[model samples]
Target: MTDAEQQYESSKPLFEKSYPSNGAAEPAGESEPQAADTQQPQFQTDEAFASAQLTLRALVSSKEAGVIIGKQGKNVADLREATGVKAGVSKPVPGVHDRVLSVTGTLEGVAKAYSMAAQTLIDSPPPSASSLSSGTTSIRLLISHNQMGTIIGRQGLKIKSIQDECSVRMVASKEMLPNSTERIVEVQGAAESIRLAVWEIGKCLVEDWQRATGTILYNPQPKEFGSSSSGGGGGGGGYSGPRVRTGNPADFDSPDGADQTQNIAIPADMVGCIIGRGGAKIQEIRRVSGARISIAKQPHDESGERMFTIRGTADENERALFMLYEQLEHEKVRRQMEDQEQDE
Candidate 1:
């Protein structure tokens, strides 16, 4: 194992330690604490409450994301206005049909925004979802895979209780997001039930955040090039497995300075997504980041990995690389889903 992996293993137990309860009620006469059942889980200390902030991230399909963003970002603006929270959608990653919707604020604002987003989705599902049963919608939130056990509780009691109380169906995906330690927990039901469930789930996350986010998950080894024939033959639809090195977004981002160039090995199959339809995606990346990027015409040696070259100032390169990383991640997830569907 690499140094990082070893360190992660050594520190693994820290995240496994029990956390404080989810705002259990204090003595009745001592003080009337905030309604933890109806609102966010209460922080133990007033100081903690004054300084606390939470950010919730959820995965939405392309169409659903469009609705959340609305035309010219009016929908997101409306959400921010309504919930008194900072609401935003991630930029479209190439070849990735799913986008992340991020809401930041106090726990109360997040819950409100989460509900508003859910309600909006229920009222305005994509046309493709019209065939589904009416009055039901699904929202997928990104939860740390390591914390799944906490959410599940011992013998599955916690999740069961949440489902029973909120009248929602919750399923946490066994598969983590590509190159990351987070997975999707899909909650499906009516808007109100979903809203309640979201609040409960958010509480679980808040309680576990200290240990969960600090826990490091080792990156799974990438498969050898051409190992999967699904999207082989240079079609760029093949699954090359996860080659992303770092999951941290801040790694590439640096203050502008000397010009630099870097080469990343791209699986032969993923080049199509990076390039987009008729090169529009790549061009967009260049336009936005002011970085010059070039793709190798042939595989790097016998590994079948194409050399993706980027050149620019530090900031520009970082920006371009960041976009590429996001694109690759989303594409990986999409392809995995496709393969799973095909297998089924």
Candidate 2:
């Protein structure tokens, strides 16, 4: 871990003041050493862990996305310039209503960015805003399945405690993201309440990641999509997979004959990015997901959306869908940035 990360680990108290203590009552005089997983990782001091380099992700509705992105992406650009954090919103994925927003930087920077984003959400009008009159908004965080149990606690007590303490309502989705080991957790309330809820949730994520990976920083998977290089720019690393086969989706059906199929409607304009140059992107998706994918040569209807079909086991289909969604979102962010630059 970098020095900043080390400092952030040490300074956890600042951001995680409300995290519940893990003090269990042991049998008197029979204090045998406990397993690391059973214990909560403790931090030394305050302020610095808030400086550790980390990334926090959330799923937001497209309307809320526009508010955070602002006209010509000015709001997001301003967010980065003012807070020293990297903020990115994935491009709109066909069939998916929510876009993934990533904020990467010191703990303090990420918190500030979220606070500003939350305020923006509150100030907006109906439908997009959760409740303007009540000064309330909601943020849906994309959390991995494994870490979720920690946040939910045994029989939902943990999640309830967090909501009661922060004065926010929190819920974890029952449905998982396609090809993903993650699900969304929605927290709603006033901006400050949301901040505290997020802080508590973020603390749990960091601790769980540390226990599993032995590191202070948490790097979520599928965090990179549609970049020129698969894994560059602190994206963790590169991707290497089996040779890709590209052709009719029918050619890759299951040998066991247990095949399930699903179709997604993709906007005509966004299909090219998912297919990538020379079909490299689609091939990669096929290889990684082991799903048979084919896009209609023509638009499905007057709506001008193409029918993208996937054939595989239930697992493969979901994975393929998730990967495809990330590709579109990545492309969307890229185009938005480009447009912003052109206006400048």
Candidate 3:
């Protein structure tokens, strides 16, 4: 937790609330010492509310993430808004079964997140496993570094929000690997809940990623080497300075700078949805943003892990953010209509 979060926790309301029997209101209240419940409040304020983290887990097959996300996190977002917590996934922990996802949040939030995961699981149960002999499920995800920033959010506020709303716990997804300074991202949870969590992740990422290509992006494009034009300015020894070529726009962005890419933990299968029909939509994203975009390969292994890369200038990056957000907003309205239809 950062300083602000720590401060928020330190100063969070801690009182607890109690209730009194209404039938005894007059006899118990008039000229008598107030009952504990009545003297306090109906809810806990300082003593009742705790600011500690709660751990959660989920499970599901790698293929079912898309169904849970619901078009750019509409379902999960709704869940968070309803529950007052931010639901998110943590990275996979090594030396454990391949099928597990981990998460974290406040106590009540974690409970609520678990409930949401259960709801998703009940909505679509995961496949059973014979190895563990447990009908329950679990799953893990390996995410890209760039994507991690989005999951973590601005100064960790986004993640905290997810923790508070989803009841799911989300810690830094990092693990040490051999021969490299980079760490792996791990997200473990109940099999079915993990499925939904990742699905939500994938949908959320679609809102952040943007495609850029060699198109009408209103920025100056890098030029290929050209024949030199004759220059006549030579004071004494006829010495002409070497031509300086401009650098790539990517040069301006620091590897440690704010991440413009989106984070989605959905199964690799859902990537195509973001790509759109016949790659037309992704192409459009690229055209509009002028950022290079690449999705992670499927069947995630150390070598073939699923991921996406977006490279572009500041304006182009902003453009990508806008396009993805726009697309998600449009999809959200469409889903709401569909939900209304099903309800009717």
Top candidate on TM-score is: 2
Query: What lDDT would each prediction earn against the true structure?
Result: 0.62, 0.61, 0.38
Worst 10 residues of 1 by lDDT: 7-16
The list of candidate 1 runs beyond 4 A from truth reads: 1-52, 130-132, 214-344
> Candidate 2, overall lDDT?
0.61
**What pairs collide in candidate 1?**
none
lDDT of 1 by residue, 1-28 (tens): 4332221111111111233244321121
In candidate 2, position 108 carries an lDDT of 69
Q: Give the TM-score of candidate 3.
A: 0.25
Candidate 2 residue pairs that clash:
8-49, 91-329, 179-318, 179-319
Which of 1 and 2 is ahead in lDDT?
Answer: 1
- In angstroms, give how far residue 233 of model 3 lies from its true place: 60
- Cα RMSD for candidates in order: 15.0, 12.3, 20.5
Query: Which of the two, 1 or 3, has more TM-score?
Result: 1
> What are the per-residue Cα lDDT tens digits for candidate 2 across 1-344?
43322211111122343645443211211221122455746544446456666667888878888898888888888888878987877556445566668887777678678878888887763274543336877788877665666776654556666766677766566556644456677776777777777766766666566422211111233433323222221121222111122234664464554677777766666778779899999999899878999888997677566778888876676578767765754554455445434443
